[model samples]
Target: MKKLIYLLFFSFLTSCSSFSEYSKETKKGFDEEDRTMVSNEAANLKTITFGDFKFATSQKEFRKLNKQKPQFKEILFYAKTTDVPYEYYVLHNPKEVIKNESFTYKDTIIGNSRFVIAVSKNAPRQDSEFIKKMVLSLR
Candidate 1:
């Protein structure tokens, strides 16, 4: 009976430790992917500013827009309707970027409910250039 109890306790302890190790590995995998995505996107940045927000896009896309109208009509509409300032509309692809839990930031929904604007006051310390641009615009 004593040996059976010891075996059960040992099994339980090992399971708990394994679970924690698994969780850590999973988190590390996510962080690595987030870093890669941010690096790639930031390298491709072609940006335009409206209010306090900086909009990022590929140079190819930026050239297609009518310079006068700026086709940010949806964005403009949301900006006018919401109490939030234009600068809050910083990130281009908010959904993907928001997955990085390491970066601390705030967000507001805008643009016909299709867009989210990410705001961060602290200078970005992480490798995400997109977040760096967002923080810089706050200054």
Candidate 2:
């Protein structure tokens, strides 16, 4: 009886230790991925100040803003509209040097300037006012 109890206790301790190690490794992997995403976004972004908030702004300012990190070759600057469900985007080249389509506005050729564009889609409406303000600021 004594040996059986001791074996059960040892097994429990070993399982607990293994689970703890697995949890730590999973968390470390997630942290590394987040860092990599941030680094990639920074490398591709030509300008951080798309809307009212800048990526380099203070942490408090970032908390009050509504923007997403650069992803899928597009940087979303603001929230999507409810009526149309559209979000503003600033497209960028994925590669180091690649000639792409020039940014345009109302059929006018805006050259290769990286400008804001409204894309139709289902997105959260968190920063509508800020997006409008930014567009107005551009005009």
Candidate 3:
């Protein structure tokens, strides 16, 4: 009984820490300015696709596609609630696949629509700029 209780506590602590890390990284994926600029861009889209991956697709389908793609490394996958509910994925390419050290991919589902955003490590400002451009292009 003691061993089972200890195992449960340990698991709880680790999961909490993992969520903290995910929340931190998700915040890093974008910023207030980007949010401000792209405020309504996503509102009108029925489908969002980036490369071969489409956002808001079934999680099972996504995993299958990711498995077929050799270059991408899936970092994390989780669901969270902000103003609305969404599923978020963090992914990266192997060093050989992308020469840049700071590159990262953030795929998410906002409501029923899927969206993908790319960010450079430690570059939240650039994240805002990139989203600004993406918003413009989407419109």
Worst 10-residue lDDT window, candidate 2: 18-27
TM-score of 1: 0.21
Per-candidate TM vs. native? 0.21, 0.22, 0.24
lDDT of each: 0.28, 0.29, 0.33
Q: What C-alpha lDDT does candidate 1 achieve relative to the native structure? A: 0.28
The stretch of ten residues in a row with the least summed lDDT in candidate 3 is 19-28
User: What tens digits encode model 3's per-residue C-alpha lDDT throughout 2-117?
Assistant: 99999999988644321111222221122333332212332322222122222312334344434332222322222222222222333322122243444455455545444444
* TM-score, ranked from best to worst: 3, 2, 1
Winner on lDDT (1 vs 3): 3
Q: State the lDDT of candidate 2 residue by residue for 1-139, as single tens digits.
A: 9999999999885443101111111111112223211112322222111222223122222234435432223232322233443444433222222222321221111233333433332423334333323221111
lDDT of 2 at 88: 41
Which TM-score value belongs to model 2? 0.22
* Model 3's TM-score against the true structure: 0.24
**Colliding pairs, model 2:** none
lDDT of 1 by residue, 62-120 (tens): 23432322222122111111223222223333324433332244444333222333332
lDDT of 1 at 124: 30
Residue 124's lDDT within candidate 2 is 36
lDDT score, candidate 1, position 130 = 56
